[model samples]
Target: MTAADDSPVHQGRRAALVRQLRARGIANEAVLTALGLVPRHLFFDSGLLPQAYQDKAFPIGAGQTISQPYTVAYQSALLAPQPGDRVLEIGTGSGYQACVLVALGAEVHTIELEPSLSARAGRLLARLGASATLYVGDGSVGLPTVAPFSGILVTAGARRVPPALLRQLAVGGRLVVPVGPADGIQRMLRIERESATAFRQETFADFRFVPLRGAEAVAPAPSQSGAETIRSAES
Candidate 1:
């Protein structure tokens, strides 16, 4: 989101975003608060800022698009983050989703494979006075040292759930991601931990997302160091 500078017009738009989110069936106070606080326009291309609160997705850069408001809200509703809950986010494109999680009171630990995007988002979050542990690393592997997160969210689409992420999920924790082919069809999926070794996965409505890319998608090219960010068609 962008700096408001106390413009009445911009403040009006923020209120409208909240109403739009509510119309889309997001009733959670924390979710609404997050959506309202996040400057969606600041997270998108300057040319696309006018439509930021229109409840649609907009291109950010690197061929990746900040997800639509509803998709963000849908997954967030499922995340159910509580105060101080450590949440892991995959694909921290513009830090919008992570901002939302923070609004919902989660302590965010986000991984982004693209260095430039990671750096930009880190700066943006810091500028907003929010602090999150930003890791310029593969989201697929997750942050092993920060395992046992209370909640996990994959902003990108994955061919299948990454096993490493599953291993990091705390027992009874939940994860929400998009699962399907990137080019064809994708379904929003939510996974709930049944035990350390088991999880129950449920598919939500169809959606689209940037593909999840990392060393797991292909062997690590020696020249690459945390440079993978593929818009994988989730399978």
Candidate 2:
């Protein structure tokens, strides 16, 4: 991390980011407060620490990019996890979003497509004193073993809501995701399970995200370090 990571300047930067999010219509007080407390700079490589709090996504490795602060806050606010709610997060990425969920009192179970990124994100979370179960696999399938999630958030853009994710959500649960063509901006969707066979979907904003890779997709080349994972896709 950079020298500013421990300096008051970084803290001030985080505060400023929170204010920016608020100005951009992020009104969830709990989400904003939790975001304010999480040190985003610590999640960055030392070289990129300076841009960590800039509300922009940065490449984390393995063709994946960390979701921007606004995107993270927007999705989390839509999911609206209650304290102690069990949340399943698809695409752990840099694990920044998982940390946010943990801070907001969710029992987070996050999955990543790349093993290296998964390992690296786990260590980062531990360093931040955040707790979340981490898994490396095809997140498109969701975690059936931990099914019935009270909240679900997908960090990548999908062609459509994966059937597995919809099936995993508990009745009355809410899922926030970005869905559209892989090469274009996606429509942010909030799907709420209203009953055993019914769901309600609300479309919000447009966002661009890395494609949500699955079991059928070819694996990315192995990386020596997750922090240095290659960006092969348009994130």
C-alpha lDDT values of all predictions: 0.80, 0.86
Worst 10 residues of 2 by lDDT: 226-235
lDDT of 1 by residue, 7-99 (tens): 667668889878987887888888888887776666766677678778788777787778888888888988889999999999999889988
TM-score of each: 0.87, 0.89
> Whole-model lDDT for model 2 versus the true structure?
0.86
Relative to the true structure, candidate 1 has a C-alpha RMSD (angstroms) of 6.6
| Pairs that clash in candidate 2 | 61-229, 62-229
